[model samples]
Target: MSETGKDEKKTKKKGKGLLVKAIVGLGLVGSGGGAAFGMMQAGIIGGEHEKEDNEPKLVRKGEEDPYAPASKDKETEGLGEVHGEGGSEYRTSYYSFTEDFTSNLAHSDALIQVSLAASTRRDGRVLLWTKKHELAIRSAILGVLADTPEEDVYALAGKERLQKRLTVAINKVLTEREGFGGIDNVYFKSFIIQ
Candidate 1:
């Protein structure tokens, strides 16, 4: 082959190799960028984005929960039973104590008969009035009664405290169960310790 022809062929091959390399590099860069962009859009890496600043933030972690705002405020106006000026109607019911206390007493290994009245909210949510648990409540009352050593059943100074503890215990049980809303308060209809 002639020298000029051989030189021309060598230059053409080099140009083709460089073009292929450039195309492959571009494809690799584009694929990486696209994957990163997709991940960002899917929110896999970014922190929680804040809502609009003007909206009222509802604190959902406490006992005094703010009511969820109505979708349309005008539609809810003058709708249901009004108690005072702006008070809404509150529905409440009593769930009687029908379960056998023998089994519970055996399980708890405590000597106490506690009858409670559960006050339910309108939305069926139950909130215990205090933080005291049921077993602790029964034990406290039993302790008090044991110390007195006078009457099997009587109104004591710690009656209110006992009631609050019982309420908390009932609420703890209810809240632990599935589909349990909450317990409002617990009223002692009767109490007997022997």
Candidate 2:
């Protein structure tokens, strides 16, 4: 073949090869993008549609809670306390730990003991979870107490901060276990430092 013709043919083949490669690359990219979009729509990738099952919800004073723990005594079935209209619209429930938490103070020989109760405005599932996970909650509480400074336990402001920390600790445990933390406040039912 003539030199110019041979060179032209080779250039044409190279051009065709480049075009095919470009098309194949574009096709692969399009397929990947489509798959990712499908996964997101199906909730397999992004968590936009993901939701907790039967998450605890706030209970109004007169509203019923389907998730509330059933009363063991038939006599108490209709004996629930009536809430007044003056306070919060939501009903508050309390869960008291059965045992006291005793731990040595941080960086001191002094010891502290406390009996605590947690409150929640949500349904009774929170209380039930608290009772069920009391062991883990107690451990978290003791860790906080052991880390608390001795002087902090004596001051009112420091005590308030400690309460907040304890509340966070309890909620962290509950969230890790049950995917939700409903504790509103942590009350010091009894506090003693020795």
Best by TM-score: 2
For 3-84, candidate 1 gives per-residue lDDT tens digits of 9999989999989988999999889888977886777677665645444333222222222323322342442321121123
| True lDDT of residue 130, candidate 1 | 16
True-vs-predicted CA distance for residue 8, candidate 2, Å: 35
**Candidate 1 least-lDDT 10 residues:** 123-132
Q: Which residue pairs collide, candidate 1?
A: 126-182, 126-183, 127-183
RMSD of each: 11.4, 6.6
The best candidate in terms of lDDT? 2
- Candidate no. 2 TM-score: 0.69
Model 2 CA deviation exceeding 4 Å by range: 1-53, 72-85
lDDT of model number 2: 0.86
**Clashes per candidate, residues 3 or more apart or on different chains:** 3, 0
